[model samples]
Target: MPGSFHGRLFPQNTIHLVHSSYSLHWLSQVPKGLVAESDLPLNKGNIYIAKTSPPSVHEAYLTQFQKDFTNFLSMRSQEIVDCGSLVLTFICKNDEEDGCDFWELLGITMNDMVIEGLIAEDKLAKFNLPLYAPSIKEIKQIIGKGGSFKLLHLETFKLKRDSNMAEKEEATLFDEKSRAAYIAGNMRAVQEPILVEHFGEEIMDELFERYGKKAIEYMKNYGKGIINNVVISLSKTN
Candidate 1:
């Protein structure tokens, strides 16, 4: 995001309303401390922060998110007019996914690929998704500490990510094969740019292709992913 404020991207105190959904979870850049001074990767077997990750890796990610979100609020607050509103929607960490966590399944799939030599361990270590799902309390704390805006309303809801696909007629049901293709296509549209930039073109096709097949298997075994989506409306008082 470049932390642009009152500059070319956004002029100060001119914008009235801003809307964002499911995007703020993404960090402006990859979290640091993923690699040690020895140039060895700090987070070695998984993609994003995984359940088995060391405490340091977890702390590193949390620190990065705090820094990024604080800066984001600071920047945008300057561009907002008095009483201008910012409505943000984001995913959170919760047990609302039944027993299936999409991120965990994705991590397992990536780790499986590493085990099978489909992708190198170092590559996995080198790559960390620039994403962090903050809890609702953490979100409120960051906003409160930002000091430029006052939160007006907050709501959280959980829903199956692909429930409609399952509710369709048997003939129209999303089978593993069809579901894999669709999931890959949809996610690739959004993630491919950053992925390619990080992992390059050679790994892009193969990685997502493998991921899609694994994702289908995961869906069959665990149903769809569930998420706690939070919406927060805040007003700039200063």
Candidate 2:
């Protein structure tokens, strides 16, 4: 059965099966510290879209995430009489000591933008995109603390991109006009509030146009690929 929480929809407790795939990575809300600046190019006055502030903020967010998630499990663990399981799939980097590769790349790009005056320096300084790729050890700690659950299985894998597609495949497939539209859509995901904060709406649009073109060219030249790891399955021990 499905239910609602605070006018937001969710599955009710009657749901014997609880499965989450690629969804847990989204923190309940964007980190608060990162959205304080309203006039910056990337700030956009929207907390959800602004970049995170200070690397420590990421840790603080994750600690709260784990605590809330544990409480959720504690509340629901007793509902299942025979067997209950929680499955999570999230994007994590191979290195546990440093940040994930995705964020590292974004950080590099963001820094370059800042230096070029495309984004505000203060915004960049406060910017810390969330990258909570907990180590295998850390995952174990979370599981142990959260619930009385037995570890059934755990695995890690890489995410790869297709090589066949051109840098601007949609443009090539359709026409120049269509290509422009396709690029706009793709850039929206990458641009948005971050660009808005640094450059405001007008300049951000121009920057996205320029950066999007270059990014496509880079992808076309250097094959597309991503390296991501995952932890698979766990069972309730109680």
Candidate 3:
């Protein structure tokens, strides 16, 4: 209905089934604490929760996710008929500390810009993604406490980073730089809007160009990666 899912977009008991893919991980907005008025940025020098992020920064993100996701469930419960089903698939965090490799790499690329006088350091410090990848345990608890749904099934799976290129002839033709550009292009499609909003469009090409190089370096050091995804089936309860 062209509205935020954080709020009800459907009438009570009107929907028989709902399906969402790769979307729930995006929170409605950035956590308030991270963007709160302050002399110093809360999550300085990085976007998203990084290895260097303070514990409070991590807590703020998790708290925001809890609030937003609970709202999502409550809103959907109102719209869905009794025992109506919800199927969702989205990125999720596993036991690994840094589940967002591309994001981290983007942050590194931005920081490199900061060092080269391409963008202001403070501007970089103040930016963060309005996204979170919850653990399965975290999701289960939230659904349980909400008391509006029964979890029918849940599973997590991984897809290789280059899975998109598997069938393409370009996969065989790509050199290191081509492969890196391909990966960076995918990230750019998702991130360009917010980045342009904050940094302006002047740097878009330069930004992704540098990002491609960083992606190649990252793969050389860490090997090609995998994206983690979680799929869940839920039924509304009376």
Candidate 4:
């Protein structure tokens, strides 16, 4: 059946365990202040938080994540039986400003299109990704405040460029263009739906084309970008 995780979807005290993977990073919706009705968008020219994003932009994203994640824990606590547990794995950041290069690269690619008249500058200015990679400290604070689950384990890991590539793909990954294409393809898979919704399907191929080239340049200059993730085990409190 169709339901939203923002509310109770299961019978109380029925679920014994919950396993969520690679999903909590996404907010229920885009942060509010970024899409104000009358003023310019706060996070202009960047899809996600970037080095250039103002302090308010960063604060807005953080607030939304906090609210969404708190609701998530509250709903799960109701569904899970006493003494049951939950395991969660999702993207995270080491620091507030870290681990945004991939999105920044995509943002720059879109900006390039704007410069060339392929996309409207206002369109680029109004778009923002509804994703946040919270720090472990932030995660701990929220769970602690809720007083519903006891944190059992929490750890972070960096996703290396070659971590899960197949042998054949690994061999090809050594080539700059091939490696860029590989990463861009993966990014497109996750982001294309929202992108198409915002920018239309006509620009999808060209968007990724520019994105791949930007990735290649990043590889040559700064090496592969780091993708940080966190896994936590929590037990329901009595």
Candidate 5:
């Protein structure tokens, strides 16, 4: 189930339970802008990539995320029985080199959209996306600061294509087309906002058509067979 943390709407300790998957990275606030003043274009490329390029605007968001997440945990920590667990999975970059390249790709794409005037130049220029992939050490620090949890199991693995296959492996459940659609769908969530901003309603239809085709081709040709997966299981110690 999804939970929300508005920082004020819900009282502290009013209820008890939290579960999240691939959701923590989506911060509540919009990222810092990235568009330059001089180069606004229309019908641009991927804007998210451009908007988040950085020394990590995502990092800035994490500061707030940490505060909120910690508060959430603090509230829950008081209620959970000792040994209760909190399990989470989030996207992360294990290698700095790989992480840098990945964010750069996203940033450059958004910059292109800005050049095309698909999104507001000022919006792009000021946009700053979060770039947080906490290491085990970092997680430990957070847990320590929160002061109520103990780490139980920590593991990181890569999710591969074959991992999606069933034991018998007679045939993959999702066909190539289906797989492409799935990947493209996820990409669209990040791309849609940029497209809308840059092209407006007039060009959005065509923009999506282009985005869909390119995303499919890119996934087929370049997507890694694997993605990094981090699993952390925490228990209330106090």
Candidate 6:
């Protein structure tokens, strides 16, 4: 389940439709050549490419995303039937923001915890979240590179942080705690093992606890920053 699509072969020409939701933005691994051997830390005091990150850092991440996504599309094209459709709903990076801005703010909190002597600066440097949110144009290029899947439909949707926990009875009222819990749970499912692997078991509870609180504050202030997501439907053509 963890291997690259190129490495893990699927049954060729068996599948009809594929639906990938809230996945595929994650790279298979950390980008190589993050920093030169001679120079100091390229992304010092930060866990990811921030709004202030240098152009080289952004280039490194985009390059890696292109490679991994190309292979993913190529493999899927071989597995699906002719004219089979694939619907992918993934976070997009646009004029708005990545769906994972919570992660970005969390990283900043981690830096503050380091300043407070709660965590080691080196640990922060070693930990980089392997995530990428591609734009529609970038996705098109990836699919084009495979030369198998034809784009059928593409649409953009927004997810407001406050809207994640709306009640069925009343759309205006928000369940803040439930919203926080849901976001925290999803993040824990994806990131707990990684955090534990790097920072040990002790940091898990406190880290995500802070993350949940940060999520609340983030929504309160920035109002989800109008997170952008793209739903792309592609068809395999013979």
Q: On residues 47-105, what C-alpha lDDT tens digit does candidate 5 reach at each position?
A: 33334334343454456566655775676676565666677777655533332233344
Give the distance in Å from residue 19's predicted Cα in candidate 5 to where it truly belongs: 3.1
lDDT accuracy of residue 165 in candidate 3: 74
Using lDDT, give the best candidate's number: 3
Displacement of the residue 66 alpha carbon in candidate 1, Å: 1.0
**Residue 232, model 3, lDDT:** 97
How does candidate 1 fare on TM-score? 0.85
Better of 1 and 5 by TM-score: 1
Tell me the lDDT of model 6 at 217.
Answer: 71
> Which residue pairs clash in candidate 2?
40-197, 41-196, 41-197, 41-198, 41-199, 42-194, 42-197, 42-198, 43-197, 52-128
Off by over 4 Å in 3: 35-38, 97-100
Q: How many clashes in each structure?
A: 0, 10, 0, 0, 28, 0
Question: After best superposition, candidate 5 residue 86: deviation in angstroms?
Answer: 1.2
Q: Higher lDDT: candidate 3 or 5?
A: 3
RMSD of each: 3.0, 6.7, 1.7, 2.1, 5.6, 2.7
lDDT of 4 by residue, 79-122 (tens): 99999999999999854344447888899899999999988999
Number of colliding residue pairs in model 1:
0
Estimate the TM-score of every prediction: 0.85, 0.60, 0.94, 0.92, 0.64, 0.87
145-170 in candidate 6: lDDT tens per residue?
Answer: 77888888999988764454553566
lDDT of each: 0.76, 0.52, 0.87, 0.86, 0.53, 0.76
Model 5, position 155, has a per-residue lDDT of 84
Worst ten in a row by lDDT for model 6 = 1-10
Off by over 4 Å in 4: 35-38, 95-100, 166-174
Q: What tens-digit string does per-residue lDDT give for candidate 3 at 121-226? A: 9899889999998889999999999999999999999876667875687678878888778877888999999999999999899999989887777767876567
